[model samples]
Target: MKTFQEFGLEPKILRAITEMGFEESTPIQEKTIPLAMEGRDLIGQAQTGTGKTAAFGVPLIHKIAIQEERIVALIMCPTRELAIQVAEEIGKLGRFKGIRSLPIYGGQDIVKQIRALKKKPQIIIGTPGRLLDHINRKTIKLDDVQTVVLDEADEMLDMGFMDDIQSILKLVPAERHTMLFSATMPSNIQKLAQQFLRNPEHISVIPKQVSAPLIDQAYIELNERQKFEALSRLIDMESPDLAIIFGRTKRRVDELAEALQKRGYAAEGLHGDLSQNQRDNVMRKFRDGSIDVLVATDVAARGLDVSGVTHVINFDLPQDPESYVHRIGRTGRAGKEGTAWTFVTPREIDHLHLIEKVTRHKINKKPLPSIAEAIEGKQKMTAERILDAMQSDAYGEFKGVAIQLLEQYDSVNLIAAALKLLTGEKKEIEIELTPEEPMRARKKKFDVRSSGRRVGGYGSGGSSGGDRRNDRPGGGYGSSSGSNSRYPRKDGSNYGPRDGSSGSSYRGNSSSEGRSSSPRERDYGSGSRDRSKTTNNS
Candidate 1:
């Protein structure tokens, strides 16, 4: 790793980087910055959290001339969220240089964007649809554009934006600096690069093992009916500070989030159907710790870079191995340890193995947490909180009440009562989720020449070669349910608020005497339980 100073960046840019608390450059930045500074076309292949923004942002900011108050650089992203995110980062990098970057995207007022355009920002970051709309309307000019960047080009292609991208690129001058970045270089992306980029310098920062080394990956096998109870127990036991739960479809995300909230968990859902404002609000709450869990679909969660994410839970398996990698990458970032748990149905074991084969890492199988274990985990958390308060002397005001209780009862029993009060018993509310069809592993062919490596698409079913448009709704590529239907209404009844008046309970557990059976006992009929735990204690 190298410092920003080694790249000979301008003082203002270095100062901004320093103030941003970036001490050393990531692998992508260290390798791409110097070549990009030399004004060469380049192709960078890296996953999302590899600092690709700064890798290109630094040089892009340095080259902009503040005197020329026109759009000299253009960056294209796949979604509105990413467009805004990139624009903000670029804005920060260029703040000291007096350079301006504006984000133009759909779902926002076009009239407002036009007004912002009149401010003469030096850089423009936008999505393909909105950018091309501006270009067609003559609201944006590319005559003076010197640099063009295709961030997440693969995602744009997956969203069926290749033609729009081609139109935008063709309008730019032939003699210009172009950079393309993607996590995977499929055939179409390669062709797009060859046609646009001029002998681009190729740089790859993809690790040999695609999964992050710091992430503890595990999977639990159970029946489809048992997933919700298992998830609730896991959350109670793990007690992650911040967690992301990935679902396969928009409906799944909505239902899962609603169910979590009904269970007294602070959670929200993100998917393509949400308005821009709604999406922004959900993200703000998640980032600010107002919500402890975020339930999201793969496309909706794209390009999301949130810090302090302690866990990633796959409520439903992703459609492909690539998606699994992207989902888990949300955690274990910035050299921090994180945990990922995948719930696999009994029939989906083959698909799980396929993911392991692609990522070249083993995902350990774990037993479903028992209800008693969930209670014990909460007890441990309460004990830790008590210890922390004692160390900080935060319990001084309560000492008199504690002394009174100690005088009335045994100290151990009083302490146990306090823990019980603080850690309320698990609500016996039943939650019934719509069972989704299990994913089947697509049959793959191995190429002997490539050392028996699998060839072609890995269960996503998109064309491996060509410029075909992905016609999936909501710009998502995978097995997501195409329907935009809301959660199904049962018996023509609407669900009540979280007061526990109505809704299903855990059917897999016995409701008699308000006690649930252990998962192993319920599922396997009194088998020897595996009590091993692999969650991060920190």
Candidate 2:
């Protein structure tokens, strides 16, 4: 129940905290802030959504004296995403105090980060890998670092950053305060604390039961490529007023946003590569319903507060349990119920179990709804909308039009037509997502084999149940090992078998396909159908 002001933060920082709309301290913040502010080592065990960033960030910002020395508080994170998120949260909390923070991570330009470091930010937030990179290159100095924080310590251990963390810790002053925050404290994390932390006061904030309590969580067991189609179908069926789709990588976010836009959904992508202004604009659009769907990476979506987000879709399953919890937390706020759907590749089932163990939430297995079912779902939405309009007295203006239309057509026909117009009819969208590297299973050979059979050998490029891999010319290739030669023609050609009267081998070239279609082209088939549906929806 403590407020930011009670935490003894300076007036300017307090003012910024109020402006940022944080009135009361979260459990982790309330317990850890005072101790951290007193310049003591602390360990906080909390999940991602418990507002742990500010728990450590506030005290770090408060204790630091902003100057050109570029040495005050250091935050080390496991991933570039988390590093950027921690830096962003620190930047927000320290805005009025002028206690600047810079994020250092790989995949971004090191020269730019070095140039930013020239600004002499008092706080440095960096991923373990790139922080070490900067230290080795002599671009960053840690001699004056007074406080060190290892955010998501367990994640760093999971990512095999233990050695790098030890090396980084060695570079910092031993007398400085150290804070470690992690969702789970494995033995390695405990060892890390013993080695570096000086009798830290432990604070454990129990993770909120967001997934199972207020949110309905389900998984669609799908192939990597089929995820998008399944997502589109779910969106149609669910008809969520607003939705957030989480993708694993920035590229995935970009492609998903683009593909959703092509399929007539107003969507935008948010990631670390985007400028602050760009991220703000995307969030703004999401809030105002200018964009109904937000496609984002976890780092970019962190700390976002978009209300009325009815659904959270995990286009790709997150790599960690904390991330899964964070992604689903976007919805089901303010005691409202929300739904979350995660698209799980066959190989990542074990990872899903790991997540279930951490979050203590059993996700239900949901079959992918067929296109016809999606249409029915949309029609149901339209039916509800129509009935509500009729009951709410919003049909007064259309009364005369209805009467005139009734004279020309039967009432049932007219009503059906109106419903069709209102409904978002089924559409076939050809989403061409670049295949992601298959997830590597971490299980015993017997476990892997059993799990593989359950998901229909999707990881091994075999069909799931009766869902055969299409053997057409443009049909998908299985894992790189098996080529089209696996389905050889009767004439010993690499391509699938052709007609019985074939003189030469069936040359399944693009030109040959086009020529075959050109002679008596009366049908464009799925391509035209998809395009027509897209145009109608638009």
Candidate 3:
């Protein structure tokens, strides 16, 4: 709870943080800023919502001179969404300091990145694959980089960026200060740190608690094809005062919000692709309760501190346990009770258990609401509205019309018409959302109990981990619908043509092409296990 000024930050940076409404430093920021500013190589271990960006950003910004043109600080991330989010936050921290940072990632135009590189930004926040592309083309030079940070180091290893990360590090000046951050220091991550960092300081903030216990947690076991219908019905049933719906990607958020609106929900979408003005506008509406539901990607929801959110729905399950905790943390603020619901495909049932294992809390299973049930819930809400209207003096002028209508029509029938008009087509709206590949959860061990219960990874049996990859023709933004085959990715080896059906060891392949396949394949994490029916080992 200490102030930013207590960390020895300069006046300009302090001003920026204050303007951003961040008067106090979060746990990770409190421990990291002083050490990072001392030019010490450090390893910080913290969960997703812990404010790691400013932990590294403030020091990097303070070290750079105003007019220095060379890119002095380099930050690497695992996803384009993460890269963009980091860059935007750093841009704010350095706004008055005259430091500039640019984000480079796949799916965005490479020509556009090249143009941006020409502007001589002082910092570059990029994904490994896209950074390698720029390196191969000789567009980005790290010769002058004074500080190189491997932000989310474990994620890079998880995503199969070990080689790229090593190569990028080798290219930077040998004397540079290096820092690495991860949520957990697994064997691979520890090895990377030992190989790359100096006698680095280690810091960690493992959250020992979960969200408020007053919040109700539940999950709906359903099929992917029927998820939207279930979601529409659930909204009508719950009637949240304010809701936040978490989607996995930008495309998913945009489409889901649009479809929800078409189905008669007051909703808006928030993602990293939006400009600051647009994000601000959306946040404004959400705060004032103008929009009842806000559909968002994880990157967009990070560090958002709004109260009065009654429900948080994971329309798509998160990739990690940390992300799941963050999504649900949006609600249950200030001792007020809240509720959270997750939609889990059958194959992902074990994955849900994995989340339970991590958080050490069992989520209750809930039945999907039926259409008639949803209508009944709506009818109750309408009746409440009618009662409130009947008590209020504001309806005095309309009494004559109400009497006249009752004379011609049955009183109950006239009220039914009013209810229908108010609710406006509560169910049965056709919406087609392009299917997204289900998230892959980590595996620890698989076991079968005598009562027909399976826990942990559940091995390669039972179900093919919900083989919905075939339905995802174009999973990402720039991919084409003509082929389910992953596009040729910028980062090689993981997506396709790597080592046959053995598949890519890493989770995310920055390429367009997917994984190799035999008659049967498994998706653990986001590793490419393309069911393309063709071998990917070139």
Candidate 4:
């Protein structure tokens, strides 16, 4: 209920917050800001969507003087996406004050980073690995750091970056304030606090519910083979302003995106294999309303913050309850009501139930939409548009044309013609997706990171899921080890395979099994589809 002004932020930072549309402080911000501004080491335990970025960022920005050009604050995250997001948020917060923040991460060009470094940014936001790389190359100096943040310490530990974090922290001056944030604190995270922070003030902001209350969650039980058809029907019915379809693997993202395109949906694929530029372009298109749907693996979708996502479709169920929460959380943001639908295979119903139990939210079950219903959905939308136009008196321009057409035809026939023109015919596209294994179970735990999403939940991939060693081509995991969601997600967790083994042996690669990339060959309605602009975001 508290406003940013209550935290005693300076006028310049307050102006930026107002410009960014933040009127009130989130629970995390309400608690952490005052202490952080007082130069206290702090630890905040909260989920991603709770405004933790500003919780720490505002104070960090407030402390840094515009006259000091050296790096005074450094934030380390587990992934490049999170690093970029934090940097952008901090940059916006410090805009009016002329505080400079730069993001340095691996996938991006190091030479460019070196050039950015030369600009003497007073703050640096970077992933641990890349930060260490720069530290080793002597491109960065941290002795001037007045504050250091382990943005998602648990995730860095999960990704085996604990040593790097320690090393980075050690490089900072001993008299610096340190802030660490994480959703869950295991033993390792506590040890990290003990070593790095000086009697840090702990602030915990627990939400009333783990999942977003504004999201209307539902699920349809169906066979895996029938998923694409069911999803297409749902899309036709809902016609979301913007939607994200979460796939379990890279191939699933690619195949589903292409399949949706085949059925006349404006969709794009996002996965780890995508070049940074390609990822940026796809995200740009999604944010600008050029793409209607984004099919993505969990890793690829991490740290994604686009508003106006009206719906979140679990084309494939997430690996765990936490992921389910995060997946649906993508929609229903900015206090707007959103819809989330999951496709549950017959055997995966139990896994869905497990997710329900953990998030303490019930997922309504519904039957797959039939062909007639899909057509009816489209008709209903067209009718609504026409009615709105009539209400607004905007139809006056079309009244003369309507009268002219009616003069030559019966009113019923004329209305039918208008309906036909307005409602697009349902496409009978035959989409055959490669079957994937379901998750072993839904027992895997997800840490709520500062960026508001898990950094490494997609099993051992970077930002998006991919086998880094073999350079495996798949972007999604639903078809890989996480397939067969009927079982537990973690190999050895209480939800693991009943046989007591990891169950990874059954997973297989389907890429060798023939697929046509040329969308022109796949007939959707009547003509060849043009896919020259299809992005290889994967």
TM-score of each: 0.58, 0.74, 0.75, 0.62
Tens-place lDDT per residue, model 4, 255-340, is: 99998888888899999889989999999999999998999987677657789999999988776665677688788988999999
Evaluation by lDDT, superior candidate among 2 and 3:
3
- Model 3: per-residue Cα lDDT over 352-390, one tens digit each: 876876676789999999989888878887778889988
* Predicted candidate 1 versus true structure: per-residue lDDT over 411-457, tens digit per residue: 98887888999987666777767666555455433434346544322
In order, the Cα lDDT scores of the candidates are 0.75, 0.70, 0.74, 0.73
lDDT of 2 by residue, 217-268 (tens): 9998988768788888898889889999988777778888998888887789
Candidate 4 weakest lDDT stretch, 10 residues = 519-528
Rank candidates by TM-score, best first. Answer: 3, 2, 4, 1
Total colliding residue pairs, candidate 1: 3
Of candidate 3, the 10-residue stretch with the lowest lDDT total is: 518-527
Model 2: runs farther than 4 Å from truth? 15-21, 79-81, 105-116, 127-137, 154-167, 183-192, 208-212, 268-291, 404-408, 424-429, 437-538
